[model samples]
Target: MSRESITPNGLNPDRETIQLGKLTVPRLFIGLWQLSSTGWGTTSVTRVRREMRRHVEAGYNAFADHYGTAEQIFGGFRSTLPDPKVVVGATKWCVFAQIDITRSVVQAAINERKEKMAYDRVDLLQFHWQDYSDRQYMDALEYLQEFKNSGDITELGLVNFDAARTDEICTQFPGLIVSNQVQFSLIDTRPLDGMGDVCNKHGIKLLTYGTLCGGFLSEKWLGEPQPDEYGGPMTPSQRKYLDVILGAWGTWPLFQSLLQTLQAIGGRHGHRSISNIATRWILDHDFVGCVLVGSRLGLTEHIDDNDRAYGFRLTPEDNAEIEKVLEKSKGRELVRVLGDCGAEYRRGGGHE
Candidate 1:
């Protein structure tokens, strides 16, 4: 559908918000991962702040994961708002190196996020640990739990954690951990291997990213030829998903077939675009609490098209049509080939 032809209604809180642990958040979150690196280019502080306000006003209240100066920028914008509590920002405490985990050290890290976001308490604090060999992550979580008890953090979550480790943490922590952030999309369906079951068993919600496959699942790429992954115009996210598409999932022709199938199914549902179809497909799963779609902040916005992904349910036939294309590819084999939800990052599989 053309930009002028696409007419989606305003955001509905009833349809969009879900009970994520102790907090109620929009089912669709504005991802700040793009602001983490310059591989996706940069926007001015003023422009970024303006876009942040625009997103919250449109009812996309939840923001997920920040790196670089995103926290400061978001903090600045947040301070100017009349009601900062309306915006929910989730930041990460990623431990890339083994350290002597101390309560003071962990408290200092939490303090930094609190200071950067200009909020006394973080809405959600998502944690990631690179090396599972070290058992100190437990100590870190122990401190985080203490802070949570003290009301310095609202809720706790995980990022890129596999099923076994996730189960371990949840079993150890019980009801304290509420969500697990992982890569879940039509192209990267590794979560289906076991993460979904773990989340269900533990009553944990899966907050997903890369649902749109970095814009590769949109109408713009429906009939186009594959671009040079390392060449002009491909952003960091596109490169990451493209590597999975070409290397593991299937050929470009097969991906095109999947896109064509999505386009046809979308035509049946009020002429919604391919992106909406993909987003709705992921959101259909009962275990999914939210799908984090990357926003370019001031550079680009898809609020209208994204809003359509909600308030509508995909039929069984729509799912059957999608699965037909999926069964023809090697999507199911990703779990074995790439390991679990986060094997690429841990095993040097070159997925960015």
Candidate 2:
């Protein structure tokens, strides 16, 4: 579809909508984690606006960001856009018992982020709880509920909450968690093992990440020559992640076989790229509402590429072969390795 022809429809869902107290975000949300201050990454206001405009044109309306720097970027971009309502934005509140974020501190963060986004009410405010054990979980949740009640946030959500803890929050708070973001890809199917049933019962959606295994799922790594290292001297996060997949999944030979099958599937769907198959493989799973694909803004242009995903199905034979390879591979506690969903931010980070 041409950029001029896209509309705010199911073909490309609206940025936000209300389903009970929960807000249904766009099928694809633009994530700005790279814009975070913790990283040395940089983005100009023009580049940011152009990227956002392209997303809007491609039928994505919702955006995800936790960085204060991202807030300022969106603020500046929003000023340039003709209509910002097409954009529904999400920011986060950290469960600061680990960091000692007081209710006042939480409120201050919300107010400050709202000021930066120039939106009085955030469409969604996802809570990032670092440690689950502290009884302060209740306290942090209550503050979030209050944030929702006070109109500072439109919907309540969680990032990387474990199944058991997420269930407790669901029952105790009644309507607090509309969704939870977790790392789930064909490569990582734990969410299906436990959380899927739980979320199905509660009418909660699972927003997944790492489906492409940081671009390892793409064809570039398929039959191509191997680099000296995963990143090939300063590897992108996605490339390094494919290395993790190699360690856990199998040798390059096994991965290449899986790629062959994925290529066949993509061919059947008229998507010839390794990435098309890799992304479609996960999108076919149950209980996944959306998958967060990363973009480097000015550095990359895969938004249109992502459109190739989800246009076809992987056959039972295909799934069985993929599973066979996975079953043969080394399995480690990825959570322990990478930290829970956004746990890379808490403390120093285990991967480095």
Candidate 3:
């Protein structure tokens, strides 16, 4: 509702930007993981292209993808843009096999990502290691550091890595790692437990996801009854976050209470939505460089609503009200169960 000047990309002139290594990107990144049609519902290529354009037009110039088909889809669309250089691309590589740790194999993986994404060099290349027990991840990072030195990768990052491991890596490579992508929403503040401190000490930033809890944090679920198992229409992301909501966050009824509280707080700030408030809450954190919101592309659109997040600031009373509800929630225990950021995925179970 604020009369802020709009940029050509549809971004508010006041919207902030962050430095991820050498690339400067918007604080809100369009998450392309939904582009992969395996877990998330089907999405047409046309929709994907349109959605990317929508984000760029709206002033969100950064996109994040994993090393899956998402890279291919995003790259394919990016090539068609009038000015592709305006977009900042970040992707992840999950090390699931021992071969991926070797220098030759790692180089091949990098080359494959470049070819698949149709980019000469990736702005940020985040690595995800399933088995921390294997020291091959260290070797992989060493190789990635070499690539970063040679300019094949603009920046090196980590996905779902814990604070201890992050610290170890920082000690090993100093300023090579710029960011760590993790799930850090109001419902899951695991990063604040220790990861935040580590990042602060090491000058590393956090790019957070799961902030909206796969749309559950939105107003659509307000006052709704808990869906019976296999009864309600839900996407894979919703189902996965539902487990987190029910498991460590709180019961369904309590979640509804929190949603109602968010609605009330948002109303005070020019009638913002629950999702916007949830995202704004994470963005307010000093350690967070950006928040990644899942974009379902053509199936659903919330660009206007999302833009509202940066329109107003949350008051201290708003934080107090949210915290009052959180005090009764099981967030601490949830962090314990989930371990550190990205522990669910490493355990062989998590939202895709």
Best by TM-score: 1
List where candidate 3 sits over 4 angstroms from the true fold: 1-10, 349-352
Best by lDDT: 1
Q: Candidate 1 on 59-152: residue-level lDDT in tens? A: 8878887777878887887787666777788988888876889999999999999999989998899999888899899889999999999999
Task: Compute the lDDT for candidate 1.
Answer: 0.87
Please give me the total number of clashing residue pairs in predicted model 1: 0
Give the clashing residue pairs of candidate 1, or none: none
lDDT of 2 by residue, 1-352 (tens): 1223324434523132234245555555677765653232466767876777777677766777765477777766665555666677776766554556469977887887788888777777777666656677678788878888889888877877777777888889876787888877756666765677777778777777676776677777778654556344433555556666665545677667777777776676675577766665656655566666666666566765666564457788767866776776553355556544455455543221
Off by over 4 Å in 1: 1-10, 349-352
Candidate 3 structure quality by residue, lDDT tens digits, 1-352:
1222223644576677888778898888989877665556776787777777777778887889873578887788778765567788899888765564568887887988888888888778988887888888889899999998998888889998999999999998899899999989989999989999989989989999889988999988999999654676777778878988886788999999899999999888889899989999999888899999888777877888888888577889999999999989999776688788878777874433
Off by over 4 Å in 2: 1-24, 37-43, 96-102, 331-352
lDDT of 2 at 9: 39
* 1 versus 3: better TM-score goes to: 1
Report each candidate's C-alpha RMSD, comma-separated, in the order given. Answer: 4.8, 4.5, 4.2
